[model samples]
Target: MPEMGRLPAGTMGLAFEEAIRRLELRNRLAALFERWGYLPAATPIVDFYDVYREWVNPQHVYRFTDREGDLVVLRSDATLFLARLLGLQLSEISQPLRLWYAEETISHIPSNHPVGDTGFQAGAEYIGLPQGEADWEVIILASEALECLGLQDYRIHLGSRALARVLIEAEGQTWSKDLIRDIHRLSGPCWENLSANLRHQFQCIGEPDQIAQQLGPFASCPEAAFLLQSCDILRSAGLGERLVIDLNEVGLLSYYTGLVFKIYVPGYHEAVVSGGRYDGLLKKFGIEAPSVGFSLQQGLIEVLHGSPEPQAPPAAASGTSWLERLANARRRRAKGERVVL
Candidate 1:
């Protein structure tokens, strides 16, 4: 029998200092989003299993049957749940809907990942906007969020779902959905019979424009063309230095229909933030509109930000009366500071 009161594997409990730092990161990111006009929103922790299965692997979700005998799951992904919550309402709404969320997510995490089964996530979604301004805005906001969290030395790897598709087709190779799913992972089978030049291109990372130019004939594909255009626009907007072209970074979600990207910093093997445009996702819910967004995982941010410094304890009261000491402590606590009697 399983041990009682023992937390499951791949899960953790954050203590005082770690919990405080996590909250501080969340509040700062949320404040940044609000400053950009992305209003706050939330979704239920538990949602219909079907709502996520299309985008998330079934094994990665915590599933159970509801009282009605229908399938339900603890939310493994916030984007899908948020999409389901706002799909119908957004159909009648105008374009350029901006929203942000900070919440906890639960899932069956991989054994090798150095994180718990549950984690705090903070992110923003830009809905109803197309590639040009919306894409640039999201990238800028991502970099800005990292900087606000005191992460200055970070890299953003910009990939293209469109370009990846074109590259596969250009190789005259047919890939099953399962194969495409495993292509970027370590356990996946390698693509055999590929040319040396093709293999090199797959591993290539450089300026977006340089990669686009090197594509030569494959540049004619519509997806490649769109990627080239967007890259140019993003560079012209002054994000050129922080950005790099990475064709091999596939998104976890199959619905990522356009540009996809991830943010990495020193010392972390996994991405700190991941987001992209999914113009096709809203339509999956019967709502036809373009959408883009990014999520910053607090676990990774804490890794980069390190532990919070201990605050100095409140000075001892002198000859003040008991009532005065109590009132003084109350005043300090009211202003969101720690206090001691």
Candidate 2:
């Protein structure tokens, strides 16, 4: 055999069964969205680097200069692309046009290991949607997507960009950036041990100093009373239990004007589902519409909770890839179901 081998970028070349399961997940989600009037669309894996950089990060993208001396590269995330396309191409599609898609995304993972990560994502953007309805739709879609993936034992952790900003402003300061970064790193349990005041502020009870040591400058947002009042408005319109408000929680996406959420599963370290409202993005493409959306981190979820998919015998590979067929077949045989490849 060759000393070592490397797969091509932008693809893993999966076999049929694994592809089927993924396609099933995508199809189910698309169908659900379609039933709600959200139309499905496709996006490219490459685009002008300027837009990507101005939107996400300038350096993280796999960038290069084209023959025309324009910066362009593989698009790591298609959210911006979709937004741009809709603003330019579908301006006549009526207000609040619902768009959903499942696609591969490339993004720079800025963490301890500093990885360049690529994975699958399914998301929907509601054009011209109002804050109240848009927020509710995103939360419901997130939960529904989990159900589509054959997963349970997860809860939607909700917060509002509007709420977090209000709390940060209420803390009697400009809100230190360093402090903001610190608070984000603390895990749940560690946030539970501090003094009652701090605990209430953190919305958790953990070693404050220890937690701070890990996550950084922390601010308190015990203004749940205020959030409850606002939440009442949403509840009056009917979506209280599906939503949770912790005045203390802050989010990373700067464009979020209101309402943000993360879906957590028992085993995954990162949020398996994440999204929020970005009312300002439409203006970036030179039109005016409020937008809200979220994407499912399918691959990471599978990595944490899914076994290596099975593959099949060689001859049957003619029709299509059966990467996980063998693995699934053996599992069935182990359970005394005879299958021949």
Candidate 3:
């Protein structure tokens, strides 16, 4: 075994410096949300497993047994919970509930993680709204948030789960619930390498050809002519070049039923932010309302941005200039600048 060192892997003296920069960025993010008229809200760290389960992927939520032996999960995602909230509060408000939140959420998605099962997330959701206006507003907010953070060279990738659903439902196919999930999840090489997962799920379902036909047009962004013929949702909610359509991007299976997307930094493998419209999500709460929302990956963003840390020297040793330095420190303190001990 090796002798102990000063810091652990994924932990370091630099992380402290990184945290300060992220904290500053967080404050700016909040101001943007406020200006957009999306009031802030917070959900509990631990919440009803069923509430989260109904709209969050099983792999994403961290489940455990409490001391009382009851099953509970740390809240994995905030958008779904907010959807449920708007449903219950529907009568209290009018159409298109606009709300935003800047809070930490827990995600077990990453395989190798350190102590923090937690992630700092900030996002907004619009409820009781349909595709056009509701979605555009969220997209604009996403763009603004990135601009506020001074991020450029990012693109918003768009797709519709409706196309995926339409494909599965088209052939009058009767796939098991889980198969529908896999087909919606696996893509490209994974879909081929992991066809085994889909085999059993496809057993009760019909031949594969029927499935391909509905998925054909969507496999690539629907042809321009086809997109022009899309429903009001896609019609009024036109996607631009920066906001591209992949048709195959089946994101967030647990909640989204249509119009899913993610914002990708030019070089990163995973999206910086991903979300979509889960109009049916609120129905599980006994209210039928359309909703859309997304969550930002704070840690990932910090990594990409290489957020700088404060690098103040330790208090200077006593010297002829010590008095002058002390006076300077006092002046900085008066203006709210920190004085490192």
Candidate 4:
């Protein structure tokens, strides 16, 4: 039997100081996102399993039959639920919805997985805008969010599913999830048998100009053209040194139809943020709007930021009554200061 007070296998509990730091980090990111005009949004923690069964692997979802005899799942992916919610309820809203969410997602993981199943994600979604500016905005916002978190040395690994698809078709090989994953990891037994040109294409990674030169004839492809344009835009916006165009790193999500990216910090081996364009994801829920977004892994951020020192409450106002002190504390809090009554 499990120990009485022990948490579940893939769950974790944060103590007071760590929890407070996490809350502060969320608040900082929230302020940054709000400044960029993203309104807060949320979805139910429990949702119909049928909605996501097609996109998600069954083994990775925590599902059970509800009282209504319908299978349901603890939210495994926030973007999936948001796509359904926006499609079903807010479809008639004006075009180009800018929304953000900070929610906990629970999923089942194999024993070897590094992190727990329950994860907190803070993200922003830009829907309805066409690929160009929308892509630039989210990618830049992601960089700003990292800066807000005091992470100065980081890099964004940018890739495009569209470009990958075009390249695969050119080589006469059909694209599959397994193939994409293998390419992303640069592994698998099939790697030895791939054509030399295909192998060289996958090896193409560097600054935008270097990638364009290496792409040779493939650079003229529409998808590749868009990607190069995006790189130029990002460079113009002062992200030139930080951007790395890596064609081999295609998106992990099945719905990603355009550019995909992952942000990495120095000490971390996994991505701190993962997202990209999923123009077709909304169509799965009966809406047909272009969409792109990125989700920041709060746990990973916390690990990178380390445990923050507990804030000391403001000093008590001298010669003030209890009521006056309370009022002053309230005012300080309103101005975003830590206070204790």
- Tell me, by lDDT, which candidate is best: 4
Regions of model 3 farther than 4 Å from truth = 1-15, 57-59, 84-92, 110-117, 174-240, 307-309, 313-332, 336-341
lDDT of 2 by residue, 1-341 (tens): 55357754434544676676677677788888888788898887777876655566655567778889997877676677788777677654356678888888876565453223668888888878767667776667677778767776776565655655554465543443333444465434333333344435545322323333322333233333333443455445444454455434455555667777777777667778888788887788777788888888777655654655565543321223365666666777777665655
Q: Write the per-residue lDDT of candidate 4 for residues 51-124, one digit (tens) a residue.
A: 88778888888999999999999988899999999878865545788999988989997879887898899899
- Model 3 score (lDDT): 0.63
Please give the lDDT score at residue 227 for candidate 1.
70
lDDT for each candidate structure: 0.79, 0.63, 0.63, 0.86
Q: Taking the tens digit of each residue's C-alpha lDDT, what string does model 1 give over 95-165? A: 57899998889989788877879877888899988776888799889889989999888888888877777
How do all models score by TM-score? 0.89, 0.72, 0.72, 0.90
Candidate 3, residues 42-68, lDDT tens digits: the string is 766776676666556677677887888
Per-residue error at 279 for model 2, in Å? Answer: 0.7
Query: What ranges in model 2 sit over 4 Å off?
Result: 1-4, 8-11, 110-116, 175-180, 186-243, 308-341
Best by TM-score: 4
Superposed Cα deviation of residue 165, candidate 4 (Å): 0.2
